[model samples]
Target: MIRTESLTKRFGPVVAVDSVSLHVREGDRYGFLGPNGSGKTTLVRMLLGLVYPTSGTIEVMGRRMPARAAEVLPEVGSLIEGPAAYPYLSGRRNLSLIDAIGSRDKRSARRARIENVLGQVGLAGVDERPVKAYSLGMRQRLGLAAALLREPRLLILDEPTNGLDPQGIREIRDLLTELNKAGTTVFLSSHLLSEVEQLCTRVGVVDRGKLVLEEELTALRAPTGRILVESPDADKITGILNGRLVSRAGEHIVVEHEDAAELNAWLVGEGMRIASITPERRSLEEVVLAATGPGADRLDR
Candidate 1:
């Protein structure tokens, strides 16, 4: 439902996004991961027509972006940077205004839509409260409700879990899962690796103004092993596993060996009785850090 080809963006002499290409299919819960200043938000802005790209193309929902963005944007709902709402207005009123401006549905239809979305976001009872009185989590929920007001085909959320408590984060995560199950395509951008690990099926990692990696979360999380052995001769065991061992944490050893069974058999035959053995898997954070290279620290700039 979304595709980009060599999308580039620049500011003065610096490039924010360079030849970045990506694609997302229907019903995809796609995660866009990057460090700060990694151009994630800039790419999202271009997709939404808030910023024009310096070169290349963006196609969203079968329509070319920037060129046909006016026709395509109405089918997309986005929460960029953060939720922007009228502080003095009630939550319901804010949504009502959005519906009036963004949708052509009748007043009664809009009201019904507003109520349904408010309930979906868990804000039904508090819709009448002024937005200024709402907590950060509440505002985030309210923003999501507004995004759903038009029943958009694509939802673009940038850091939707920012400032949310554990309960609120879980709530939003569950809501997004439900939406994707119902056939809504979700394009999520966030700095939280754990959240992406839990919520996304596929992910794209960006760094230093370039696209670094894009792959299924499962592929990125391929199982690896970490063995912790308690032996009378810990140093001796470490020497035997020299090249295969990745690191050491006190008496425990973390290794990245291809044949765990062979290693175990060798250890046992060598008179080492293992007290405990634990396997470790690569996490989303680890995969991202590896793919982006050591220069990924530019994301913090």
Candidate 2:
């Protein structure tokens, strides 16, 4: 539910965001990927109306942004860079205060809404300890709870799993997936390629302040005319497809096959006991690397 046309932003003599047209569908889990100094933060700020663009247009939820921010932003949730809260206040108290700001909801229902969002973000039954005592992960969870406070229709998150162990990351991943399935459009900007590979349905890669790639994850990762086969009859299968075989490593074999299904059927008919067979596809990492150059963070002598 977000669209931009030739969106550009400048700072004095430098351009932070170049001419970039971006599209995010209503129910998509979109991954916005870029390296440091690639202008991801600038682009996100423009979308949130925190920074006005130098040229072009932005639309969120089918309405012009910044101009219609009051009408559109209430339905949009965001976590940028990281979360913020009163360090001395309890998490619950922090949420209560944030929830009360410009909230049209009834006072009596605020507590329930707060608790529900807390539970959703894995902060359920949290003690009343001041936020200063919470670990980084807890603070991140607290921030997420704040974002979910309004049951937003669109979520724009940056580095959402910044300070957590693998389990916590997985928990948040599952939570985001569930929200997307329930019709919340997610715009995730992350440096973690694996996380986006697993979570997002579509991807947009930016480099040098320009949009480099934008496409469905499936299409970007299409099969590469090769099949990986694991089988008990590796030797026998190798002999049967000698002309097409690319390599053999113990029970695993790589074959130059256009269709895994056809190769699988041919092996099955040959009385080969196959363990597993699937077409090889480029990883999201491979695709993104091919599309963009070195990150701006790298310094060469």
Candidate 3:
């Protein structure tokens, strides 16, 4: 439930965010993607009211941002930049301190929230350990716990899995997916393409401070298969399947078709012995690069 109209932001002569429009529907696990210095975080900051936009409008959860921040942001949980926790304080104590700043403003319920978030982020038993003794992954989980302490309707996470191991990444991915399934609108900005490919249902791609593409991940990843079949009787098979998109490459016939089963069966019906059939489909990363062109760099931040 976020919409922007030609949203622009500038730092003196430098424009961090250009005229960009974006839409994120309710219940969408949306991925906000762009290469390094592409203004992804700048846009999110404007949406969160951490910074004011130079021009344009922003509506989040049906409320104009900054102007309605008090009404809209109370319902939102965000982890921008990174997690901050006192090194001397225990995880439980650190969360308790962070919970004090929650939108609910219920200092009386802080203890219960501390425990609830510690458990939610997989730090229930070890929450008493000092933050200084915690691993990087543990600190990341603590940051997430801080974000969830409010139990807001919207979650805005920028690089939620930054500096995490493979297992830690998967853990965070599963947690975000579970949260989205349970009705929390998730807006994630990540450098990991594979993570976005696996976790997001919709994606908005940005480049040069401009919004390039916004669409369902399913539509972007639709099945457009290239079937390559090898056989000793390649000539006969090519002749039978000859079309504008069908061609014979060496001893193999390559057909641009969706159904590999039907294509394979067509060749087998002619009493042709088939060696093997392979279906090649363009992946989400491929589609993204195709759309973004060469401006797409290694976004492994």
Candidate 4:
């Protein structure tokens, strides 16, 4: 439950965020994607009231942001950059400290909550270890546990998968899925398209400080007809198809088309015997780049 209207932010002469609008429905796992310096973090900070917008309106969980940030923020948990923890403190101690800051119910209850989240993040038995000794993945999990200490209705995560190995990433991904399934709204900002493609129900793409695309992840990843044909006379088939040949794997040819059946029929009508034909679907990354155009190359910076 988040909404923004004409959200704009500036740093003197440079506008970091420009007239952007976004919406996330309740219980939605929404991904906010943009390249470096595209203002994704700036927009997230504005939503959290950590930074004030130059001009715009923000409503989070039905409460207007900035004006009621104090009241509204209590219902939200966020990790803006990386995990913040006391290096000298044990992981359990770090969580206990956060619980105290959030005014959790009681010492025992807070400890229990911390343990529960730590376990959820796959750090069950390592709580006694000092944070300084923990790996980057462990620290990330610890940060997630701290964020969940408050049991907020909304979770804002920035690059939660950063520094995580494949196993750690899967664990965090599963945790987020469970949270969303339990009705906690997630607004995740990430540079990893693969992570977003796997976790988000919907996505918003930004580039050059502008909102360029927004859509349901399923729609964006819808299957498209792609055919891989292998024949002795690949050149003859390519000429008959009148379509651009994408690539060749040995004697096979990959061609993208809107209708596979039509292409097959055309080939058969031309008296060409097809050895094999396999269909393929476009991926989320491909669709995103297509929608945003060639400018996607600019996102790396």
Which candidate tops TM-score? 2
| Alpha-carbon runs more than 4 Å astray in model 2 | 231-243, 247-251, 268-273
lDDT of candidate 2 at residue 221, scale 0 to 100: 91
What ranges in model 3 sit over 4 Å off? 102-108, 228-254, 272-279, 293-301
Error of 2 at 193 (Å): 2.0
**202, model 1: CA deviation in Å?**
1.2
Compare the candidates by lDDT and give the number of the best one.
Answer: 2
Please identify model 1 stretches exceeding 4 Å from their true place.
225-251, 259-278, 293-301
Q: After superposition, how far is residue 44 of candidate 1 from its true place, in Å?
A: 0.3
Instruction: Give the per-residue lDDT digits (tens) of candidate 3, residues 53-97.
Output: 999999999999999998998789888878888998898888776
Q: Which of candidates 1 and 2 is the stronger one according to lDDT? A: 2
Which wins on lDDT, candidate 1 or candidate 4? Answer: 1
Please write out the lDDT profile of model 4 over residues 97-198, one tens digit for every residue.
778874838778887888898898888888466899988888888888888878889999999988899988998999999998988999999978998989
Candidate 4 ranges with C-alpha deviation above 4 Å: 102-104, 224-226, 229-249, 256-280, 291-301
In order of appearance, the predictions have TM-scores of: 0.86, 0.92, 0.86, 0.86
Q: State the RMSD for candidate 1.
A: 3.2
RMSD from true fold, candidate 4: 3.3
* lDDT per residue (tens digit) for residues 222-294 in model 1: 6565554556556778888758778776767776665557767788899887766655678898888887755
